[model samples]
Target: MVGREETTMFHRDLHPDGRPVKPEEREQLLRKVLPPTSYSDETTRSTSPKPVGRKRRILWSRFVTRIHLILFAIIQAVFSIYLRSRYLYHVIIDRIYTIMYYPHRTPEYIRRDVKALSRLPTHISVILDLHSHDRYDADSSLENLVNDVCEICAWTASAGIPVLTIYERTGILKEYLQDTHRAITQTLRSYYGQHPPSISLRAPHLQSISPPRSPNTLPADATPPRLEVTLISKDDGRATLVDLTKTFAEMAQNRKIGPEHVTGELIEQELSDLTMKEPDLLILFGPNVQLQGYPPWQLRLTEIFNVEDHQGVAYHVFLRALHCYGKAQMRFGR
Candidate 1:
């Protein structure tokens, strides 16, 4: 017996009335049967176009970069202008001062004046600021300082300056005395090889004057002069001052002298007796003109000249300092 084939129903074709459905209708029926799912706002937004703030942020970033560049350029321009103006001001001022104060003083005139005055200062002291070591290139700065000292010594010798004292706060010159002496000797030999003046470290005692040669010494000044170089440090000043005070106190106690009797002159004399001679001229090589703890007693009548940045200092600078010293008129409390 022939039987009718049984019909099968797929999930998409299923309906309450048992009728077949199209693809679109089946999709709609499935959607109604399933529960609704919740989606995050961020997920939904990400699927759409970016918001207005994104374009604004991009524009703001570009604006900030341009502003930074503009600010940097402006700062550089201002700094350049300031430096140029400063340089111009210095040039104008220097020219005016030179014209007014040094009208007849040509370079040759200044040099001659310095040479003549160099012979006058029996004891000249150079004070170097050791504190500037950190600010400069160490090796180059030291080399420059050594060369400067050597040149100054040779020049002093040439000009018949009898004694030179080099002072530093750290005793650096004292520590390098041998090297300094050798450098000075070399410099003198290089400059005046034929008849180099006798340069030696000054002894602690007062230098003795040679007795007149057989009473026919050509006015007692014809003999060749000697160049005595002394290396002094802050330690010398401190030690001398301490010793001087102690001695003065002891003498006063023993002699029953009052405080009024121990005058500044007395102290000065005592210090001079201890240290031998006071400096006639004191040249300071530093940033400022003030003496950085130099021996107070020695500077009573000393003419001080300041030259900034002693490293690689030219011979003309030293000559200029000497010229200044020569021109200065000291009243000494007239």
Candidate 2:
């Protein structure tokens, strides 16, 4: 019965004439229909030997990886050392230059340049980085500060700059304005053998209106020209702008005027009445270009110049700053 069933299954592919297929044809058809038998795991294991060079390749890869890591570390170390050497070299060179080739500007040369400027700034402001004060011995730092202030005063006196403002970050100058002013004036008088200028000191809270002067009232060569020296510090802060704006807003509310009526001219006039006039040129003496929380309202149209390492800075450096400012083409919000 089993043989008959198998024959029936095989006969399903027979020709329509009902003739049984030939043995060679039936064998070929069986070969095409059946799946090939797979080898057992044991047979594969016996036939295939383990790859000969796998361990060698792994060891070589590890060795190469270690070599790459070692090279990268060496390169990193070399680059770090190079950067350190470069920085030290630059510092040494800067010190050498300061000791040897730094140019000193004479009072006559400064005066000449001041006159040569197409239009001299009416007011000049200076920012001193007192954070650097700890770099030197306390006494030496104080002496240097005095000398720097005196040098600035001498420059302003020579250039006939009428208004000079000084700012420090921590109120150091503001706290010692009387002592600093006395020292600066004494140094100027001793050095120049004449009164330098009328230096009027004012605090941030103080308000004083300068008397109006008619144009052409003062001669060109006015000796000991009226110099207004204003000293301010962090105590003033940026609240000057905020306070001014608030005052104007309150005023507008009280007067029942529109906020648009509060114009910049009016704000500036009020500020001038409270503080000194806005600075035209701001000379920052430090390693960085940051203002370090300087009054923002005054710097809107100001030209800024930076001097690196201003402690015991050369006079020619100050002159060069002025020269740069003179060459600058100012477009006051054109």
Candidate 3:
């Protein structure tokens, strides 16, 4: 009885008329008794938002959004058309060039085509993307990539570009290094006779693969007549830079190479020794000019070639890339 009285006294509702409150009336009586802010004043405040201004703002925002979408759609359509047209144009031109330029008969034929160029790259790097119409299956894409590498290697060899590096971002080429070497040998044999230019197939960390010298070829020497073919991947890209940095840090700590010894020339020399030297020309087998992570450090003055909407590695595109490289004047940051 005393407890009930105490509770009633604490929660008593005596708003103006001194009314005892029920559960339904408790909130109202308490609010009436308390000093309410202007926003909460039941007599003066509105719970719903104003309709006219809000609706007008919403309508304006929707209208602007619609305009942006339309503009974006139009721009996309135009760009798609441009890419398709450009790809077709290149295909037709390349087809025409093949009849006159592609070395169907012999390696000498391709060499003749190469001879016409004002200059030729000593080292050529081809960026091979592991992408194809074979979307659902990865194995199919890998085969296509291998075939692309084989074809490009043979072409570069025929063009007499002494050094070639195959850049596939995934490094699948390096993973299947032996198979790639065998395939390249077969491809070269198809182009040349049994004894093609010797290909030194090597990846970054693996042992270099070189087949036995055919009796029909040159005598055993310190450096035989061979094509230095390298396989590089994303690991050889920025990852190499990071690794190099770590190595330099360790070396500096050990007092081997000082911090000042880590100049651009020093890094370049180290990288060249570790990997291949900077390529003179970089050929992209894809339709557009996307690096797709070719080593940035190696591409300071490299001549890069791209054909819009063109897909796969074509011999004609390879030839055209060479032509483009020959014509390009490397000012080297002039």
Candidate 4:
């Protein structure tokens, strides 16, 4: 009756192609005809940038973490290599020097080396690390530290370094003073027979040792010592200062001297009398540069020397320190 009602899927009967379209089928058709969501989805774009920024931050953090790990590994590797190489270098050089100077006991040879230096220290300070008798020190005394002290004393005396201050951290050297002096005498006798440098051995706050002459040597004919040896310990470094402070306070209370008179010069003079003078050169026997609680007040203008990776004390190291001192120029805060 209406010119054959137009039969087409668009008819208002609400059936898409003879049946209602399923939700999945409708979504698929829409997606196929629609543009990319990234370009057309304006409502979701603000949250989209948020996710992108978050992702970028996560990537950046990961990158930085990786870089830090890489740098740390490189630095650690370099430091390890440097330590190994440094130790090897010192060992080889020490071996060569030992061979060249096989016998270091010749007095003339030592003197000649000293004479070549531009200057020599009058007072030399030595830091000794404690060592025990073992296969390494079979030729030395069972008391290795004592033996080292005696050897150093002999070397200093031979070098004409009159004032030698020996600092041992544990004060073990103080216990073996007698043995050390005896050994030093023998070593000096080897260097200068019959006229070994006279040594006056004393420790801080203790009386100078005046023992009976050894059975083999002459009794005192009333001659002063050429070498004045002082034994100081960690205690002497700080305790001595505390003692001086108490002494000054006691004196001030007694009206003996005013606080104004307790100046640096006065304190220095008192210290010089109590301990040895501030040394012109300090020789550390160890490889590292550790002061080991040396008297702080005395090291204000001192020159310090050490050999890298050196395990033990040796005469050549001592000699080399002296040579270095000769080549140095002291400003003293000019």
My TM-score estimates for the predictions, one after another, are 0.56, 0.64, 0.73, 0.73
Which sequence of candidate numbers ranks them by lDDT, best first? Answer: 3, 4, 2, 1
lDDT string, candidate 2, 1-334, tens digits: 2355455646785644677667886786576555554545667777885676677888999999999999999999999999788767756756664564333434455576567677777799888765455565766666666677777877786687888888776766665667776776676566455534556666677543233445465456755566677877765656776787787778777986687777888877777766667788888765568888887777878889865544435555566577788889988778
Per-residue C-alpha lDDT of model 4 across residues 1-334, encoded as one tens digit per residue? 1122222322343344467655675465456556788777776764566877789999999999999999999999999999999999998888876666533665667677688788999999998866433646633634777767778877787677889998877787787678777887887777777767678889987777655545456555723247888999899888888999999999999999997899999999998888768999999977889988899989988999999988688887888799899999998778
Query: In candidate 2, which residue ranges exceed 4 Å CA deviation?
Result: 1-106, 113-116, 135-143, 207-222, 252-257, 307-312
Q: After superposition, how far is residue 36 of candidate 4 from its true place, in Å?
A: 28
Per-residue error (Å), model 4, residue 275? 1.5
CA lDDT of every candidate:
0.65, 0.69, 0.80, 0.79
lDDT of model 2, residue 14: 67
Q: How many residue pairs clash in each candidate?
A: 0, 0, 0, 0
- Tens-place lDDT per residue, model 1, 11-39, is 43655477766778656545654555554
Q: 98, model 1: CA deviation in Å? A: 15
Candidates 1 and 4 compared: the better one by lDDT is 4
lDDT of 2: 0.69
